[model samples]
Target chain A: MFETLSNVFTDNPLIVSFAIIGITMYIAYKLSDKLTRGRIHGSAIAIILGLVLAYLGGVLTGGEKGLSDISIFAGIGLMGGGMLRDFAIVATAFGASFDEIKKAGMSGVSALFIGVLLSYVVGVAVALSFGYTDAVSLTTIGGGTATYIVGPVTGAAIGASSEVITISIAAGLVKSILTMIGTPFVAKYIGLNNPRSAMVYGGLMGTTSGVAGGLAATDPKLVPYGAVTATFYTGLGCLMVPSVLFLMTRAIFG
Target chain B: MVIFGVALLAICMLIGIFFGEILGLFLGVEANVGGVGIAMIMLVLIVDYLKKRGKLSLPAQDGLGFWSAMYIPIVIAMSANQNVAGALDGGPLAIMAGVAAALIGWLFVPLLSKGGLQTEETVEENTFIGGENKNVRNIK
Candidate 1:
């Protein structure tokens, strides 16, 4: 009877994947609410947990697909594939409101542009100093500075090596974590007291999870405004990084 | 009725991906560019248009809500798919680049916020209501 039930679950890999994610989310949120008192958002905590699991899976299986390398967890490969990841991200825009977006105005718009550019510049300089002189690597890593999602997307689109793409992702993850932890500490000093400033902050920060989590800590009220612009920032980064930015990097580095 | 929302999302996604691929082709890139982002923009636009037309029903809204709620889980899965261990093996360059970008971005916050158009008093009331209502609805 136990073997039959286990076989049934293993046969339906996606279902098993969902169950694992569900349990992970439950634990992550519980940790957020009880342990951290919601100072850190559940999503950030979940990502950390997921990363740890991935690391462990890599060690245990000595395989590339992380936890999915284990047969029972094979569904994780499909669940975490690009298709579903893209679908979930696309679905998030449903919650956005045009009326709310209009409130941010010109400053918010310019902040997005400036934010992407500044991050790219900083990322490129760091990449160069680290002796990664190739245009593809520089552009991909620069895009990663914009956001983790952008990093991988740009890298793949421009045919960058898998190693470079992974590094780019790691770079983006570090940015997201820092943004989450650093927001509240610097909020008052930066005049992040109002919705407008929050919107500008979001546009500048560009990482949605980071901005959302940080704003939640600083002022729960500011999260929405920051989130809206941060979403736009991601979209803008996605559109810009692989095309125009890649061209620029090629021009300079070549 | 909830299926209608899913259908709508599917239609928008198809169109978005098509355009994204076209954009990629134009730019000479092999991979799809901004497909997900484009789909998101389309969903937002389409939903807003439907809402304004009063064509969106409660069930359809529920469908959107269901998927929106799935956001955290999907993000977790995506993060899990990343090769963090491999990235770490490449050394501290990745970590340095990320920290530098974040810090420099933070340093510019005050400069960007200095000359904003709206005063806090006038913009406060309307934005507060909109922001709070959104938070309640999304719950993320």
Candidate 2:
């Protein structure tokens, strides 16, 4: 069943997304309490949306041309899957968890600022000794993972990485840092104040993000949902995005 | 916040290009989206509009409410297009442009949020996930 579903979606994601959406809306309609409603509804949107994207992209992918024909949809689907997953998390999390995550997410902002500041400071110091004026790429090249995660907005804003590569790295790293930073805060704020106890929650959320990030990072169909979460709401679906993936893998293959 | 979302989107994309294939392979799962669309949306909507209003920060009971709000636009949008990308692409060129617009939102979001009354009213808060919301059940 699991393998079959995966093959189905893998073979045709658009059809799968449509199927999932149908099932999901039904689930949403039938779900009783708010908690359950939030989780099911949030996840339903992501999975279905993912299916829609993959299916459409598959039209291009499954054709004679592979990804190139489908590249546009491929890009869209790969991006969509991740976006939907984020939406699931934030929407499911809703107001309460959304705020908590937001508060904690600021840590990523701080790291982004620090990384940029230090990277340039050191870059210029070395550049002066070298007698070169083009030290600006210091922020670009030096802007590694966090900066990339934060994106070129800051890179461009700070003039860190006008070039695409540096901007990408700068944004990516910042998000990773933010994710890493968020877990600990989630632990501390969520009740496990003790470092050891907190680490347990932190570790769990951290691991979840890694998996979720990985899943989201690859799937384009889910991008819209991820965009929803990353942009506006709570990440309660954060934990669920991965869980659903696990569930989907199991349901489809098992 | 919108600024942060854009950065995350770009980073996630880079990661998708590099590590995403590997991780997705190991995980035996599709690992695709990676938050780009969210960044697009954030850019379009602005962070302050995207998120729930932050008041005392103790906690919010409106988790379900928030989800309901988010679900509306997305579900409707998804239904309209058999292909999500096709639908988004069909929309205004601004969305298709991605990060450029998100930059615009980040620059101006605070201003949008600030336009409303500054004093926040006290609202009910939901502290736990299922912990406190056990009464809550799935929409199914």
Candidate 3:
């Protein structure tokens, strides 16, 4: 009976994957409510937990694809694939109000450009300090500072090496985690209380998941405004990093 | 009825991904660019239009509500799939670059907030509707 049940679950990995995620979410929420008194959102905790699991999965299986390396958890790879990720992100916009978005106005628009440029400059400076003199490596790493998505997209467009692309992704992931954990703590100080400020914050952050998760922790209502601008930021970064940013980096470094 | 919302979302996602691929091609990149963002824009437009016309019934709203709340879980799952360990093992430069970027970006928030539109009354009005009521209930 046990073997049959195990086989059944493995056979229907997607269902098991959902069940596992659901249980993890429940525990994470409880931990947030009881342990942190809701100062930290459950999503933040869940992300940390997921990262830990990913690390452990890498170690235990000595394989890529994290937990999906295990046969029983194979469905996790699909569950976490870009298709579902995009679907979930798109679905979040259903809650945003046009009135609120318009209220963000010119400040919101400017924030997007400043955010991308600022991240790129900082990324390039760091890459230089690390002794990477080539424009391709510098541009890829710099773009990663904008967002993980932007990093790979930029790297691929400009013909960056796989190692550089991986490093860029790591940089973006760290930024996302920082944004998620830091938003609630700084919410009050930065006046992230209103939709306009939220939009500005999102534009500055530029990482959609980071901004969304962080704003969710700060105030659920702020998520849509922040998410909308952050989404735009990614699009802007993709357009700018490979062409304009790459050329600028090449000119400076070469 | 519940499926209607998901169906709409699926349709929007398909359209968005298609456009994203086209944009990527135009830019000479091989990856999908801003597909998720485009899909989101479409969903928001469609939902708002439906609401304005009373075409969105309670069931459809409920369907969207379910997925809206599911955002966090999905995000968590997506992050789980990323190879954080590999990145860390690659080098400290990645960490340094990321931290500097995030910190500087955050430091600029106050400056950006200073110049935006000033609507004290609107902020107060929205606090009631946006902060406390419908959207937040499902989150906690």
Candidate 4:
């Protein structure tokens, strides 16, 4: 019976992939509700678990594609590939209304630029401190600070080393985790209860998941507002990091 | 109704992807140029227009909303999972970069919040950050 079930999953990898993700999400949500008292979002927990599984997959398969390297878990790669990623991002934008966005005004717009620039500079500084002197390495890492997506996108655009690109991604992930854990603790002190404030905070924070999760814990009502601007932040980072920021880094380091 | 909304989404995504490809070609980049962002803007504008023109019913709007919300968590998870294997093997510099970025970002929060908290005297928006106010319920 066990062999037959295992063979079934191996034959139909996509179904197994869905089952794994579904189970992971269920457990993550349960953990969030019970262990974290819903302070941490289930999505965050699921991502961490996914990463762990990916790591284990790499160890088990001795391959670079993580779980997808294993024949039975090959479907995970397609499910989490770039096409669905872009689709999901576009879909999320459907809920945003123009009038609500207009309410944020100049302050919110400026926050996006400020947030991207601040994180980029900090990322560059860190890269330099770690003894990286190349323009591609510095810019890619700096872009990662803007957001994980930005980091890899910038690296691929500018032909950065894979190692540098990975480091940049790591930087972005660290930022995301910190943002997730820290937002609720500091929400009160920052006056993050209002829509306008949430918008501004989202712009400044930039990581959609972190800002959204943090705000969800702080105030469910504020999640939409923060998410809107954080979405903008990601788009803006993608735009600037590879072109203008990469040029600046090249000029300075080269 | 769901099919119509999905069709609209598909149209927007197609146009956005086309435009992104053009943008990427023009910029000499090898990847898609913000196709998702473009598609999102197109969807937003289209949906809002439909809403104002009375072309969209409440149920359809709700359906669109449901898909968007459902898609978001999935998107978040997918993006978070990207490149973790590479990062883990990138050695100590990668780990250091990650740690430094998080630490600095956390520390910088105070300075960013200073601008927000200092202006609490504004009478226009009565809602404060920390404590619950009745007005909080008014936000969508």
Candidate 5:
């Protein structure tokens, strides 16, 4: 399936990278389950979403040629998932009923707000210190959800530099570590006032959060999906008009 | 999944860097970073809506969450692209960069949170032994 990817990296680095991540996450997920009670999380929805984006990006980008190709916008969709993920976070927070929000570990929107607030500050500070003010992206926004809420480009613009591209990458690393080393602090912040200040379920949690929230509100499950659709549509903002211009030019000249 | 994420990202960024500057100037747009952000949201929405409605879901948005996690590695790897990736190349550097960033988060988060204990849901117990089980501690 990824033979083309094989030619690109050292004996197909990209395919190997994906295989490694999938296998590792699977093992980690399994090991975590074994080590603890049945508190393990499954990522059915997120995995489904990731694969769809990948295939389409590969297809659309490859077909485009001129400076005005429509597929350039498609490429943007891949990097911008962080922001889309946050929209999911926001929808779940606002859309969820009082009961559902409680189930998800938020007494109300305030707790969710605290999490987002902390993430945003941490995200920005890391970017400034590293001089990567323009290098961030937020593909999966909720767990640490900083750049995700702000949107990927916004994160990157906040953190980008001539130096790096994952300004939120700095944010992500900090978030993962906090779940471990800074457990006391996180426990205090995320757990204080309300024990359910934030839920750390990951991508699947993101799905569940949205689903549960919508279910509580009696909204369609499709609403969360709508955010992604709007983001991509807007993401294509500049690309749409120009590609036609370029296409017409080529057609006339050739 | 992240492998694809990283690979796709690397491809786009590399391409964008070459053309992003030109495109940015011409379009009067910010860096194309915003474009990518907008795109992911659109991809997810289109994919979810189509599937539930019995229409075709975009292949791109399907299963994207799994791949999104790979973003960590991509960030780490790309951080070192300029140093070049040979055997045993970016492993240590990424770790160092990550650790440094984390230390700041750990140190600063507490300071930023400042006296969040005020937000405690319940009062603290002053004493725990012998008839001194007071929920409120009085210091005189």
Candidate 6:
């Protein structure tokens, strides 16, 4: 019976992958509720757990792609691929009513541009301080400050070195983790208790997972509102960073 | 109803992917254009329109809700698989740039959060019908 069950899971990798994720999420949420008193979002804990598992998988298998390196966990790679990632992102809009969006008004609209430009400028300045003068590298790293998705997307578009692209991703990831952990701590201080404020905050932050996780921890009601604008922030970043931002960086540095 | 909602979502996704490809071609980028974003917009508009018209049932709305929130944890996990190890090897400068962005971005929170009250109606609405009483579970 044990051999047959193992064979079943091994044959249907996706099922086992789902089972692992399900169990992990259950434990993560339970820990969040009990240990942190729901201060740290379950999603955040789950992500950390996933990363740790991936690291261990890499060490044990001596392969890249982490857990997917193990044959049984291969489904994780597909499940987390661009297709589902994009789908999940897009699905966020379903909960966002246009009427509620209009309620956010012009402040929400400007927040997106302000957030992107601000992050990009900071990213460029930091890159410069670190002695990177090339236009491609500067723009890519700057885009990373905008969001993790934007970082890799912009880097690939501008043909940055793999090392630089990886750095850009790291920069974005750092921003994401910070946003995830910090939002709850600062929610009360920033008055992020309402949907409108959440929408504006999301626009300013631009990291979907961070905003969602942060808002989930702060107030689950705010997650959809924040996720909506964060999604827009990503689309806007992808649209602008490679074109307008890249040109500006080149004109300045080259 | 659930099946119908799922079908709608799939259709919107396909169209969004197609539109994104066209957009990428036009922009001369190798990446897919805002396919997911566009699809999401379409789904929202269509689903809401149907809901407002009383065509969508409660069960269908619930089904959409379940699917929408289902993948979030998985997505978060997938994102962790990014080439963080490679980025760490990009030297101290790269690490500094990343750390600086995160810190500076955090600083912006205070400044960005002060957008202020827009209209009297919104404040009233939030206090009366919004605020803590408005649950995320009932968003659909």
Highest lDDT: give the candidate number. 3
Q: lDDT rank, highest first?
A: 3, 1, 6, 4, 2, 5
Question: lDDT per residue, candidate 3, B67-127, as tens digits?
Answer: 7766667666765665656656657998898888888988898899784446534644543
Error of 1 at B86 (Å): 2.3
CAPRI docking class of candidate 6: acceptable
CAPRI docking class of candidate 3: medium
Off by over 4 Å in 3: A1-3, B29-33, B115-140
Q: DockQ (C-alpha) of model 2?
A: 0.06
Candidate 2 stretches with Cα past 4 Å from truth are A1-15, A18-89, A95-133, A149-151, A154-254, B1-140
**lDDT (Cα, tens digit) per residue for candidate 5, span A154-208:** 4233343322333233333333322222322233343222212222212111212
- DockQ in order: 0.39, 0.06, 0.51, 0.26, 0.05, 0.34
How do the residues B49-135 of candidate 6 rate in per-residue lDDT, one tens digit apiece?
787688877666655655566655555556444443444444665566656655564566556656444432453343212112333
Q: Please give the distance, in angstroms, between residue B29's alpha carbon in candidate 2 and its true position after superposition.
A: 36
Cα lDDT of model 6 by residue, A10-115, tens digit: 7887677777888887888888888988767676677667767766766767665667777767777766656666666555566655666667746667778888
* Ten-residue region with minimum lDDT total, candidate 6 chain A: A216-225
Global local distance difference test of model 6: 0.69
In order, the Cα lDDT scores of the candidates are 0.73, 0.31, 0.78, 0.66, 0.29, 0.69
Error of 6 at A106 (Å): 3.1
Q: How well does candidate 4 reproduce the true complex, by DockQ?
A: 0.26
Residues A102-181, model 3: lDDT tens digits: 76767788999999999999999999998999999999999998988889988888899999998898898888877876
lDDT of predicted model 5: 0.29
Model 3: pairs clashing at backbone N, Cα or C within 3 Å: none
Q: Rank the candidates by DockQ, best first.
A: 3, 1, 6, 4, 2, 5
Error of 1 at A5 (Å): 4.8
Off by over 4 Å in 5: A1-9, A40-254, B1-30, B33-37, B44-140
